[model samples]
Target: MSSIAFMTQAQEYMFTYSKLFSHLKQNVKQGHEDVKVGLFFLNADTKKNCVIQKAWMEKEQHYEELKTTRYNELLLPLDDNLKSANPLVFVRTPQDQRCDFSMVVMTKQPLKGTVSYTEVEMLLPQMQVMLEDLGGMFASWFTPDVEGVTLEFQGLVDGQVEFSNGKTKPIVNGKAQVALSDIGQGGSMILPQETSRVLPYLPRAD
Candidate 1:
């Protein structure tokens, strides 16, 4: 369906593409659309809908070029608060259906702070609640047409959440660790390394 169709069919029509792209990376053509493109989907450490891809293309639009435009259609902005709280929303599409759109609470800067293991443990409660709330909200929006989810960031990233066929596995180490002081000093906001758990799981819009 088109973007407008998504809005009319689902309540969480507008969402971020980051997690949607991240979780849907494998299904997202994995690498750049063009071999010469410099941009690729972001390798985020969080599970928000990290969709969309970064392409260092020539910025030339061509009918046959097929460079970054392949992924550009999916970009959309979302609300803030996702980053401030670093909350992640996880959704399992309707039984055998594909998710048409994803809605993530965007973050301004992907969390790069150092907190003791105690802090992560403390943050778990709030994160869990947000995840549950988001899931419940989007459950009714899933359709069997495709196989995937849409993720939009509010505080950090936001934009169009369109329908596409892609997939990405959540980045999970399983062995959780608490951050030490200055642990995240070397990493940039976009390049998140010392994240608590990069557990994002998305398949494709089918």
Candidate 2:
């Protein structure tokens, strides 16, 4: 089985567990007929309403609810494993996003029922890198043009920052570009007309 992680626009992580049922079937074919699989969501805080919102299998034409434990952990039944290759289980959670939450795949023996913090300590380094990469990808989804306007501010050489439309930009070498925009009105800038610089009079042509 393999896990794929996705980041939603609301900053939530969705995990899709795939090839699990099929893998269990392979184990059955290898003469180990009683192969059992358990999917555990480790490090979830039940007190803070951190629970899985939904779990479903992605089929050809529709979705089927994957049976999970009361706490949303999945314990695959031997009957289901022998029947078909239902290879996908999608799980969505609305809790605060953190990579510390890991989905563990346990097989053969009955699950330990509890995961100690020390057991997952080695996973932090890899999870942290994944988190950082996901964050960068999330940020790259919105560019300056879509989110706001980049306004270039000149004449400030004192290393000051200019603020507009709730955004700020630090002035560097008398120039700074600020991303400014209003939620509904977009963005606008007003420039004073130089009325004192009058144009020279011209004679009418025949």
Candidate 3:
């Protein structure tokens, strides 16, 4: 699947998971007054697992050219023979063990009662990129004009990248309000106006 298509799929999964999270908060009522949803991309700026990190970095850089808005290649881990394996998403518990969070994106069913065999998987290349740049996976989706959508991806290619350590570099971060009408815009929904108002010194990607 192309990058655009992958974004759409990921959004759908996010929506599904979000709804499921909401349901869990409501249903498992310890009369639980506090309720929240949405899973964050945890530790997004740093590596979490060494094995996964090595596999991802070793993959050929997606593209050769170095551009500010694009990303390089991504790699996924697999069995010894280079076969694909399902990527696992989990939260770290205080016990130092991986706790299985009930995620709806991976499974179509409720994660409470039965064994959830659903494995949410995506091509590693789809994720290995500077997510907040012009040509990155997040760029187009974040547009203000974009509303509810199910994007169809065309193709995939290796791409360019800009140089700098991730920590100091500033991405075009801005605030956005995702009303019900703006459901399909993925994580970013910052408008040009809001971005301009908040980030006066931001550089133009184009």
Candidate 4:
């Protein structure tokens, strides 16, 4: 349901997309019996702030002021795996404030078998686009510390779905992996120092 990623000087606490999607689906189903929500992709950025106030004495009067200008917020997505209809939620920096993708089945009873085939076909290509954008945008985040680190996700189905944008390979075995650093370096990305700890980092999505 939740996990924590401890960095050299940072701490990231967030939720897993799969679990969140399951929860959402359950809620949606309960809210509307027989209604199934197919979630293809989800990216979101949210900012939250905590204010600290202090009192100071000036001359004979007391004054109160907010102490800091920086704000604190949590960034997370509905899914992390780029699988068929599976939620792929992750966190990223606040610099890019955008919600990349999200899809929901508005009707009662979830789409099944051939009913979902067409939609999946349309969704994979678009997801690949997001993948390329994400890889290039956060290329700098990859360090030797993250060398060989990869992400894989797929949908549970009776058959298979393969997708590629020419630059990347097809999704095989119902799974796909995108090397975060490989995008920027043309297969020449430098590696970070290998260490005991695996730095957990994800670009914030909206």
Candidate that would win on lDDT = 2
The sequence of per-residue lDDT tens digits that candidate 3 reaches over residues 1-206 is 11111132222111222222323333233322221121212122321211111111122333121111011111122232222222222222222222222211111111111111111011111111111222345655653331111111112112111112211111222222222122221222222121111111112223
Indicate which candidate wins on TM-score. 2
Cα displacement (angstroms), candidate 1, residue 194, comes to: 4.9
Q: lDDT of candidate 2? A: 0.36
Encode model 1's per-residue lDDT on 136-202: one tens digit a residue. Answer: 5564355222111122223423222111112112322322222222123232112123222222213
TM-score of each: 0.24, 0.34, 0.16, 0.20
Q: Estimate every model's Cα lDDT from 0 to 1.
A: 0.27, 0.36, 0.20, 0.28
Query: Between candidates 2 and 3, which one is better according to lDDT?
Result: 2
**Model 2: per-residue lDDT, tens digit, 60-156?**
7766776765544555545554346544556666556432344332223221222222322322333233223323556334321112221222233
lDDT of model 4 at residue 40?
Answer: 24
